[model samples]
Structure formats: C-alpha cells, structure tokens
Target: MDALGIAVIVAVLVVATTIGLWHRRTDGMIRDEAADKKRRAAILAAAGVETVEFPDRKSSNAVASAAAKAASGAAAAAVHGNDTVRAANAAARSAAAGVPAAPDLPADSGIAVPVDSGVPAPAGPVDEAASAEPAGADPQLAEPGVPGVREPGDVAAERKSGVVPDSREEPGVVEAAARDASAAGESLDQGLLDRLGIGPAQATLLQFSSAFCAPCRAVRRISGEVAELLPGVQHVEVDAESHLAEVRELNIWRTPTLLILDAGGQVVKRATGVPSKPQLIAALGDVLPDA
Candidate 1:
C-alpha cells in the first residue's frame, strides 16, 4: 500500500478503537449507576427510613448543603458548582411540584447485588450484632415523633403570631429539636407525615408485598387491612416496580417485608415474607427502650 494510504488506514483504526472504548465505558457507567441505586435502596431500607421519600430528602439536602458551602465560599465557578447548584435547585423545585423526573445517582465504582428476578430476603436473620437490642434496651429517641400525639395543650397558647421554627437560629439543632419540639410550627407536619404513613409511634403498614411483585393492588389491600387491625397505625402502599426508593430505603429486597419503627424513627424490626397480625403487633411493641 502507498505510504499515505497506510497512514490513513492506521488513523481510521485508531479512531475506531477509541470509539469502541468510549462505548464500553458508557455502558459500564450505566450499569454501575443502576447497581448503586439498588445498593442505596437497600441501605436506606436497612436504616428504617422507608417512608421519608428519599428523592425529596436528597434534593432538599443537596440544596441546603450547596447553599451552606457557597455561603462559606467553598464553591468554585470554574468547577461549575454554581451551575450545578442552580440546576439542582430548579430540579428540586420541579420535583416538589411533580414537574420533572427524579434526579439520578452519580455513577459509582462498586458492584451491586445479583440479578433480582424475585424479591429475595436477605440470606439470614438480621445480623445479630447490628440488630442486637442494645443489651435489653431500645435506643432512646430512635423514631421521629408524631405530631398531634401527646401534645401539651399549652403548646398552642405559647405560639408567636408569625414566627416559623427556624432550623437556623439554633441551627444544626432542628433534627433533635424537630423531633421533640412542643412549639406550634414544629408539630404541624404530622398531617403531611401521616399521609406518608411514617412515624415512630407505630407501624403504619408501609406495604405488604411478595417477590415478583407485579400487580400490587392485592398486596395493598392485604397490607391495608392488617394496618387497620392495629390502632394508631397508618398503612401506605408502594409497589415494587414504581417506588424502588421505598424498597431501597427500607432494605426491602423481599416482598412481604415489614418495617417496624419506634416513635423516634429508628428501625426496630424487619420481617421478610408474610407475618401474622400477632407477630407484627408484637414487633410494634418491641424496642430497646433506652439504647
């Protein structure tokens, strides 16, 4: 072959090789993202935060974190932090308004679990060490407090005319304060929370499903009935297909998983497969109490 022709062929080969590598990298990225989401879901579920609507928390926290960093002068325009932050804020607003898609997870370098054709429970019982009942005592204040629950009537009389409970002012103290606040603004989110069916007060019957969960209507009905059987409990349904976040948040790899929490928002029980009403009721009453 002529020298120029040989050179041209070599250049074409190099370009093709580069394109192939890029395609492979892109595919790997996609796979990794999916795996991370699954892992994240499992992690969240394990933490007993199943009903908090992760996408909202994630978006809200991202915005708050960004604002804090910017306020501290840690963001860089050259790094496009401003643009990214702006985009996240806009996305957050859209997500709140149901006007946009949920944000995607950043691609990761770790592998996720095996192919889940069926909703499989974890291999064994809750890891004894992690699930240990804090030496016969439940952890103190692990569950989030339920509003309109045991509220002191004087809480309303002490309210200001227009002041909202600022998570600032006291700053970084709201989580604990928000959990224990007896003030007016601090206790009103219960209706919103009750609608979501999550609180430490009792089992809200988030869901009762099974593996290969497709048509989740039946599962919802069954779960609802069981939840009703228990007073002060709210039942909510999340189909495995539609709300993977809830599954991941509550480590619900198995359908028919039950998440039992105390009023402090801590996960005290995780039951996979169908559990009887008595079994579930007993779990609701179970806690470490002082751990």
Candidate 2:
C-alpha cells in the first residue's frame, strides 16, 4: 500500500515477534530455575542437611513427601525456635537401637563426635590416641622400604591383617637387603644364569660377593660401574650366603669374584676380589675384544 502504512505494519510485527520471543525465553528460564532448585533440594535432603523434612528411604512416597515436609519444616523451624522434633525422634530411635548419632561428623577442632547409644558414660574418658584415623594416616599404611603395599586397592583391612607383628625391619635394611641379594647364589651355574635372565645370547659379567665382608662393596661398586659402561655386559651379582652348596659345586673359594663370560655364555676371564676399573675393563675386553 502506502509507504508510511507499510513502515507502521512492519514496526508492529517486529514488536509482537520480540514480545513473543521474550516471553518464551522468560518462561523457559523460570522452568529451568525451578528444576535446578528442585534438584538441589533433593540433594540436600539426601545428605540430611536440609532444613526441610523428608522421609527416610524405606517410607512410601519418600522423595516427594520428604521434599514437601522438608520445605514446610524449615519454614516452621525458623518460626518455632528450631523445635526439631523429628530429628530428636530419629536420634532417640538410633540411641535405643544401639546405633550411632549423626554419622560422627567432625567439628572444626578435628575431634570426632563420641559414639553414644543412650548408654551410660565409660568409667574413664576415652584415650586421645585411641581415636580412629581417616584410613590414610595409619602408620601401617606403608611397609618400610617397600614402595607400594601389596594390596593396591583398599588398604584399610590390609592394615589389620598385614600389620607387622611388632617385629620391626632393620634400618637401611633395603640397602643391606640389596647387598645380600647380590651375594645370593654366589656360585650360580648355568641354571641360575637362566633364572637371572642371562642366556647364551647375552654376554655376562658375574659379581660374586659376601655379606659382612668388607672391600667387596668397593670392588662391586667399581666393577658394577665399569660393567654399566660396557653395553653388552649383563652384571649378575651373586651372594656368598653359604660355601657348602653351590660354591662347592662351582669350586669357588674367593669373595667379590668377577667372572666375565662371552656372548656364547662361556667364562672368558676371572678376577678374584673386587677388580679395579682397569682390570674390569680388561676382563670385559677379553670377552668383547673390540671394547
């Protein structure tokens, strides 16, 4: 039609469309907020920290009736000096049944609520140390020198079962243990070689040692260091636990002995006592001529 008439119609249509969309958005937002509030109310009721009353799980219409009761009870408690009649009744039932009160919620002082079953107080006060810890702080949480306890998950029950029966492992026991482990099977033959993951295809440098024997450490340290530098060499540290068995079998007498074997698993060079770094390199050089 006319230009002014067209402009007026378009303006009216735009205003109507904007109003409709605005109302729709407002309604959606209101609905979303109500749903969120209901969800939060439900969560609070589940946690038992809500000001409103909700029936316990066993009750019929527990969730709905409980939510309504909780909202109403909260309003009532604010007006009625926090009567908490329902809470008191629940607590009373808990006490009579020898159940604990209020889940032992800790206060800001870090002390737990003392368990009571409506019973008389103990003849004496509870010991401060006897308080149960929150799982992780138990001293038995870790075994000494052991990185992770055996039961990887749920260590609580393990703390009770694997509780070190008052017999303490020695200090630096791991280091000493490692040393003793090295001395173990001092005269390891071919079978022990296979057990140690040393095969015919692998070159071997066996370090024989004895526990409580001095100078063996220095020898082991030097040979071990030199063996580390030699790429193809596999250092097998054997302990001299007893001379009567494998040592007698292997006809070995000296301690901190080094036996260099070629890739074919044949013994090529022998050093009695801890070999010097040069001696270690020379022994390996015989097995690995190029090195």
| Winning candidate number (TM-score) | 2
Tens digit of per-residue lDDT, candidate 1, span 1-291 = 599999999999999999988755542111111123335556887998773422223233233322222211111111111222332233234334442221221111000100111122343422232122221111111112111211233223213211222323333312222222111111113333444456544334556464575434454554567667766666655455555655554455656555444333333345554555555555544321222
User: Model 2 off-target regions past 4 Å?
Assistant: 1-189, 195-202, 242-244, 289-291
Q: Model 2, range 100-174, lDDT digits (tens) per residue?
A: 222211111001011111122242321221121101111111001111112223234433343211112322212
Candidate 1's C-alpha runs over 4 A off are: 1-132, 135-201, 208-222, 287-291
Error of 2 at 284 (Å): 1.2
Whole-model lDDT values for every prediction: 0.35, 0.38
